[model samples]
Target: MKFIALFAGLPLLAAAAPTQRALGMPLQGDLCMPFQHDLGTPLQGGDFTAFAWFEHEPIHPPIQARGLRFWVGGEPATYCPSPPVVHCPPGKVTAFSGGGYGLSVMVPGGQRVYVSPTGELGYTQAHSAYIPPGSFLGPFEYTPGIPFGHYTFNGKGFIACPNSKEGPTTWKVFAHIPNAIVPTSDIQDCLPFQAVTEIFGSPPAAWQYT
Candidate 1:
């Protein structure tokens, strides 16, 4: 990026400080922008809050069936008891924040969101897929900068769920992770999606969160 400035009455041009962000990626690039249905828009340039969610089927040992949202594992599960959450995403929480490189994603308490070196999908690189303030942003509004989590370390495998149980399953952020199967018991509003076929192996029967 370049900038214009006046040095002692002379017009001088200088380069802006370089940073990694998700934007201006080639259409065929591994990392792509995510779109949200509730907001009726896709993410814009610059950093912003992102509330992650997806449906939870009872296949991970058969507990209960319901939708789940991305909340910090050490803090609390995503809940809508009365109000929305208030904490902020930590500073310099990169990883998928750029098309080429990413910093690192750390929660408010201190734990970090671990990603695979190959940038495919991973859950056990450390312990859990549960991390905090998992927001996708461009950081640089002008350059459309995307970070590593958006793509991968190698800039090849555009970060996605390869198969069953690769961890934090995602085929790609298809309009918000399989529509966050919300439990009827939870009074929170569930984002709606049009389901033509797969509910991620869960039967269409209604279930509750335990």
Candidate 2:
């Protein structure tokens, strides 16, 4: 399928400083612009993040995906609560309770939610389909101005920037590897495409911080 440009919010990478940082991921190209979802207006202190993994020989222009991995602080994610309140998602605690981190999982066509207390984000070089059950791969740390995780596959993932970007509203996608499934013949069918939704702070007092 032909690719379509996703235009949302203020372009972060567009600011274009004198020089661009090296994308540590396998792909040796400049970082594409920071991505934002059209769901809401651009809020300060929060920026949408993603990355592009240039395909190996044969495929041109590269591909990217949201390398999503759910983590709550230092542990893996669990099923969201049935009622699914804003502060906590059912039983899962991917982050701290108050002023902590909340996560929503979106698989190919399904969704899962988790909460965290460590303010940590989860990302994996491995795809959700590839991840085995009963595995807890620690949280993915963020390096200011650089991609988040290691370089592996074309998959891309982002952490929700719910709070004030002033203090720690950071989100990024790092680690890009070529997809083994999609061959040169199918690169066109596997171009990067992602739709992510992140809601920070519940309301009222939450609005002030978010």
Candidate 3:
């Protein structure tokens, strides 16, 4: 099944970048604002997409999320009152993007970064919480006060491949950042980009958002 985003009010404008300390590390594309509300979905193997504004430009092409890809392995993913899960083919399940909030960031150094309404919240361990939770976002909430920036690439970085099951699933979140060049901030607000959000995951299904 294909996924679709159902927003309520008008889109909020971008805010000044947050302090570096609150940022944790350098961010990419743009600094994303937190989702003050619940952005959830009721489908497995579907798609969710949203467009946000940046104070500057991105470093790679945005993602083109489309189509029914993977089988979340259980009931449809949900959020709001609780978190959601992005199940794999079988018992090995993980949550992709579904929480009370959303965030954006860059990788490696800073050559490229990302901004996503979908908060990729990874596995919940007894220790720290894993970001980019393992799947793509379903219902994305946008707000003002978000920051935006590009990456510089300090050294080598990680990329996701369809064959690497052990690789990080958060790649689905950053899939919209400019990976090769830079994206101008002159795109439409509600339209994600003049470009489309692309797909990232195995067989390209996990990252598929139509």
Candidate 4:
């Protein structure tokens, strides 16, 4: 079950390098902006290949988003959205290049983040979403007005693995019934894993409009 993205069309970089970003309600005034980031796992010593971007397809501005990607990291893992006053913001989810209300895709998860009664952790993708109820965003290591930075998702940073190979991984990411169950039959997979958003700076090399 390959996941659909929020915004589509933006050409992808080599792999999480530049030209993509997230889409959230951004923090106010000289704080942070959405940019490409790595879903770093401190446990693995940050080795494995897991990246995330706001628009999974990496579409440029002047249009709506195609979709979003989490856990597996799309083609070019990282991305760069529009300006805060224009589009992507600190810890935000960008839906387009230059800022506009666009489509926000839901992978297999529900609209909100939750944990199932059977122990399955559920999450979703949106243009403007709040951190979990009690969970607050970590800190801002951004350069005041920069389009890149880092932060902690606290409890929401948790993720799971699946029984299948790269194919099954997509199932786990999309889940079944939105806030339903994510199966894990692999021992080496879904083993109490978590990650942090590690971002690099946004540059002109990041995006191009169609």
Q: How accurate is candidate 3 locally (lDDT)?
A: 0.22
Q: What is the C-alpha lDDT profile of model 4 across 74-183, one tens digit per residue? A: 23222345454344222223221111011122222212332333333332343334333432122212111122222223212233344366442432332111222345
Which lDDT tens digits does candidate 1 get at residues 143-173? 2322211222223212112122323422221
Best candidate according to TM-score: 4
Clash numbers, per candidate: 21, 22, 34, 33
TM-score of each: 0.21, 0.26, 0.19, 0.27
After superposition on all C-alphas, the RMSD of every candidate to the true structure, in Å, is 20.6, 15.7, 16.6, 15.0
lDDT of 2: 0.24
| Candidate 4 residue runs with Cα over 4 Å from true position | 1-69, 74-151, 154-156, 163-180, 184-189, 203-210
Candidate 2 stretches with Cα past 4 Å from truth are 1-5, 8-130, 133-141, 145-175, 183-210
lDDT of 2 by residue, 15-113 (tens): 222122232223233322322223233212222222332222111111112234321112223432334344532322222111111122322212211
The models' CA-based lDDT, in order, is 0.21, 0.24, 0.22, 0.27
Name model 1 segments beyond 4 Å from true.
1-107, 117-152, 157-159, 162-210
lDDT, candidate 3, 1-210, per-residue tens = 011111123233234433222211222463233322322332223122222222232222222221122111122222211124344222111212221122111111111112222322122221223323233322232222223322111211112112123332211222223232112222111111111111112221221121
Model 3 spans with C-alpha error above 4 angstroms: 1-60, 67-140, 144-170, 174-210
